[model samples]
Target: MSKFKKDGKKNTPAVSTASLPDIVFMLLFFFMVTTVMREVDLKIKLSQPDATEIEKLEDRSLVDYVYIGEPTNTALYGTLPKIQLDDAFATVEDIQDYVIEKRADRPEAVHGAIIVSLKVDEETKMGIVTDVKQELREVQALKISYSTREKVNKKKF
Candidate 1:
């Protein structure tokens, strides 16, 4: 006689749930470390000009942005467009200091590679842009870029 009988059905083990929380937490931590957030809360109303030729910067870490536009609160900041450096409203004379401080934050070797991008509103005066350029010259930060929108159809990306 046979010692044991063979059964047609076999039981399958349940799927493990222990590692599920670990994966969820790991994904949360990964996004927290790798994601980049908006640098500043823009107080100005900006409408960038259109451009046919535009080139995207390769490394965002090497570029700093300067924003110029009319204030969202016209009653407080008035109708004239204002210059924004970092989080605060600044004058044309403040560009040198701002550039110097920004350069100091980066590695010495990359200081020369840093580019200052001007995000100017279309309705803004040209004089302010000229002054900002002069200030950059004083700091020896010659690399510059003008931020503009691409001339594309609404449906076309």
Candidate 2:
């Protein structure tokens, strides 16, 4: 006796495309709220050195990145100081202090392991690299790594 049933036509299921946006927005909001934003506190300029031997990193969780570069010398004869990771920290203590403080607050943050990924210019001297490594060693940074880019041009040839 219903108006829809009297005609003998099947009742069509209600399709919803309207709720799609709401669902998507809810997911977006969830991700936005729950995701941790990594803070990049240092702006470093570095030119990667070329290397024939490349090694894959087995452990990445213990790594921290540091960049080294020579400051611009306006005078042609001016002596340029070799800038390294520790030197950078001396200039800007905020990032290093934050990490150290965080480690103190959470003992598991560092977990008795430290690795520094050093990014340096190709023109940087070996002595400079050694000095940087030594400085980090003094700070009890047990692990050190040099960052390098893989050569891709060989594949084209």
Candidate 3:
């Protein structure tokens, strides 16, 4: 008959899982702290039209932004280059030539692809928008996008 004694005898297996929660929490905190967030800055004040469908811009590499606004009537405005709307309208040919030059300069990643993001003021007339679109079309820039803000609380199905 063998006698069982409680002296210098171990019955449980030894495995170290004590620090697992701490390690997991540390990794989670590291990822949360190092994450990068994308932010879009508005160059002009405009009341964006609401839309039920949201179209995400897929190609980020081949994109250029244009800001259109009237010059302010103040001393500070004098320091900035005055954008003569009349003259700007006449420079349609020059603008098209510049776009072609810029398109050639773009890297292969965005080669043969160009997207223009037009930011216009809320008070901007439809005729101006049409004119800008036509100019872009003449440059053979078929991929055009109008800037607009997304509405909050969009219902998802």
Candidate 4:
């Protein structure tokens, strides 16, 4: 029994990190799958007009939005109707090019089906909207949709 005296240097089991990477990667994948990225930060104010007759699009992927309204920073942009493509302010003349480029970005198979949804603010004039339509027509992007909110029923309760 004296020969089996306790040794000062005793080996201790180390913690296993074999599944650490797997757990970390799983977390990363989960975040990647769950995260929803914002398309753009609107520089202009947008309040959709109320509509009595409006239909939702079947496929939203094929749709591109064109925001039309006065700039939120009226001091910088002045109080005038402006067109926003993606995130930047664009002019009426720039619409044709914007449409062309949008078409090129998408697959050719669905170019004809791609819809340009005009999100015009209620305060915005129809002239700007008409101009946008004209540009879309020039590019042959005929499939158009107007973004509007459902009219709330006014009930006296």
Where in model 4 is the C-alpha error above 4 Å? 1-37, 155-157
lDDT per residue, candidate 4, 19-77, as tens digits? 99999999999999998676678888899999879999888778888999989999999
Q: What is the C-alpha RMSD of each candidate to the true structure, in Å?
A: 7.6, 9.3, 10.5, 7.7
Instruction: Give the alpha carbon lDDT tens digit for every residue of 1-117 in model 1.
Output: 444555547556699999999999999999999998988989888899998889987899999999999999999999898999889899988898999999999999998899999
TM-score of every candidate = 0.74, 0.49, 0.53, 0.73
**lDDT preference between candidates 1 and 3, better one:** 1
Model 4 CA lDDT for position 128: 89
Deviation (Å) of 8 in candidate 1: 40
RMSD of 2: 9.3
| Pairs that clash in candidate 1 | none
lDDT of 2 by residue, 1-157 (tens): 5654555565666897999999999999999999855434333345687676878666665666666556544254233434433334333334355345434654575546656677777776777667666655555665667888876557544
**Residue 127, model 2: Cα distance from true site in angstroms:** 2.3
Instruction: Give candidate 1's root-mean-square deviation (CA, Å).
Output: 7.6
- Candidate 1 vs 2: which has more lDDT: 1
The stretch of ten residues in a row with the least summed lDDT in candidate 1 is 1-10
What residue pairs clash in candidate 2, if any at all? none
